[model samples]
Target: MKNFIIICFLLLVGHQTVNAQKALRVYVVRHAEKLTGDPKEKDPELSPEGSERAQALAKELKGQKIDSIFSTNYKRTKLTGFPLADKIGISIKTYNPDQTKALATQLIENAKGKNILIVGHSNTVLEIIEAFGGEKPVKPLTDDDYDYLFTVTVKGKKVEVKTSRYGASHHTEGGEAKAMKSNK
Candidate 1:
């Protein structure tokens, strides 16, 4: 009876460990650079620099098990997510920008314990992050700025957030204004 009880305990512990390891990781990124043509165009594609940035973003996310990819029905968003979707062998799903909060909530619930990737426009990316309980505000990227990455991980009711700027030298909390890197 003692040996049987010990075996049962071990099995229970193993199951919990596997479940914890499967917790979801969601990455929200802004669409890469855009074409410089007329602003009146209904849908503009990625500019040359934007295309390069998309490739760079792909390289950054390589080797991760990205289960689902979500993007708005915009050319830039679709193009930005293409490389990563191709790398992971999954198709991109389009969500309504107006219903972003609801859509993100649904996806988060459906992805319970799974990893997901979402690509959005400058105006909505930060909003999505906030919907997920992030305290950071959305900031606009300049023509020369292209390397802003938000890595959000949710485990049970706990959350962790990290930011990596492309060419900038420092980080700030809760604002969109550009700050110069500290000389130190």
Candidate 2:
């Protein structure tokens, strides 16, 4: 009877241990292109090309089971996430761009065992990825950078990061953006 009790105890402990390790998947990206030409504009909406790119992002991740979507409280970031949020039937939650560490903590604590997407600025995307214990890409994000997609996965204490691209290529030949034909 003692042997049976010991075996049962071990099984219960193992089960609890397995349950404690939460596996989380997060997709992070800088907001798509914003309207340019105004250095004083603190919160500009996305350009028309950026809008199309946002729609492409939605199409890219629509099949994935995204539980929550987060964005900075800016027109660009919000617009970047709106397409996906609308497709997933979830609302976009705003987080402080200056408080990446806090947001990372919140994600780890509350977003365990789920899938998440975060839209941020070029400066903040890497910071948020690092805060989540994931590796940043080799190339630093710049104002002109807009096509990198980062996937951060956390299982137990293990963190893995992968980088890829989505939507229109921001880096094209001759440093010229593909001319977006205006609807007007």
The residue-by-residue lDDT of candidate 1 on 15-123, one tens digit each, is 7776665556878888887886897987899888778878877888876678888899999999988988887789999988789779767755656676777898777
Q: Where is model 1 more than 4 Å wrong at Cα? A: 1-22, 137-145, 166-184
TM-scores of the candidates are 0.75, 0.83
Clashes in each model (backbone N, CA, C under 3 Å)? 0, 0
C-alpha RMSD by candidate, in order: 6.1, 3.8
Tens digits of lDDT, candidate 2, 102-136: 88888787777888999998878888899999887
Which consecutive 10 residues in model 2 have the weakest lDDT in total? 172-181
